[model samples]
Target: MSIGNTFYQHKDIHKKTWRHPDGRVSNEIDYVCIAKRWRSSLLDVKVHRGADVGSDHHLLIAKFRLRLKRLPPTPQRARPFDVMKLKQPTVATQFQLELRNRFQAPADCEEAEDQWTQFRTTLTKSAEAVVGR
Candidate 1:
């Protein structure tokens, strides 16, 4: 553990977190402590005099910045379609006819990803209908 008071520089009034009842004496009695390993994450520590806590000690504020770890993405598994059905003459002819009737070129210029997605959808639907999945 480490004391956060010494980590930051501030005015005397801001540093004084506590005061004596006589009003003639004051001191930094309050403290903000943190782990030594995360010392660099502690941005600033100071006293907030504006807070009306109704106590001899003032409010101590500590600022910190933390970065969360990112998770690794899981790989997606692709399902295999029944391509063996295409060996039959009737299935092959029906698959070819379905592709010819459903396939259409884009009306305007489009992104490569969009075109690939459209083509993949058409092929998958046609294969499921004419062949099997």
Candidate 2:
């Protein structure tokens, strides 16, 4: 996403000072009122005026980091148990059996083994989602 104008320019990241339309001057930025809560963390803010190719409004970039309180870690696993049963005994062992059963060439069996390895990685990552224990 950062490929096209994905970055923001921060002239004053910490705080943006702009005159409000009202008689009383106030800060101005694109965000809504709630941004007041986040303004304090602003490290840099910049205004970029000029057509960014086709976009009408000038682009603005802001950079800031949140000061979050300490948080606990979350843990997850690859799978529970059932998916294991679906897979053949040992991938190598089953490779031999299936190859023999189908009269498949060794090269073909090797290809199948490679496929199963990919499946194993994807399946493991999908099933494991552990949090605080």
Candidate 3:
């Protein structure tokens, strides 16, 4: 309360920020203090006594004159569907059929990594067909 122009000098109604439980004592214990550098940005600060919050303390509001710069829109990418739904009997049957129709199992002599890649691709395509993107 001893700062520069930020001091509270308004009427008693506007100055009181808190009240005692006995409904007899009130005090200006709450505040919205701003740094000296950005003091000009603080347009107004006051207590809203009419806003009911079921508390003894009144709501303190501060208004600023700042304008936030808008950021460019971000590009959205398509996300994969959840494959866990395959646990359902109907969904599992459809997914299995789709995979069986498209799957070309790697040859017996193929590398393990190649077989894994093919399996993953087949599973992904089956899920996409059964559950959508």
Per-residue alpha-carbon lDDT of model 2 for 14-97, expressed as tens digits? 233343446364343444222556655666555455425453333555567889779687776533445453354565454445
User: What's the TM-score of every candidate structure?
Assistant: 0.55, 0.27, 0.43
**Residue range 1-133, candidate 1, lDDT tens digits:** 9988976779999899888889989999888888898888899998998999899989999999986679898897766888998999998999999998888895563888888888889898898888876
lDDT: the better of candidates 1 and 3: 1
Candidate 3 lDDT by residue in tens digits, 44-115: 777899998999999987777875679999999869687678779998888888888998858873688989
Off by over 4 Å in 3: 1-8, 67-133
Superpose all Cα atoms of candidate 2 onto the true structure and report the RMSD in Å to 1 decimal. 17.5
Evaluate model 2: give its TM-score. 0.27
Worst lDDT window (10 residues) for model 1? 106-115
- Runs of candidate 1 exceeding 4 Å displacement: 76-133
Best by lDDT: 1
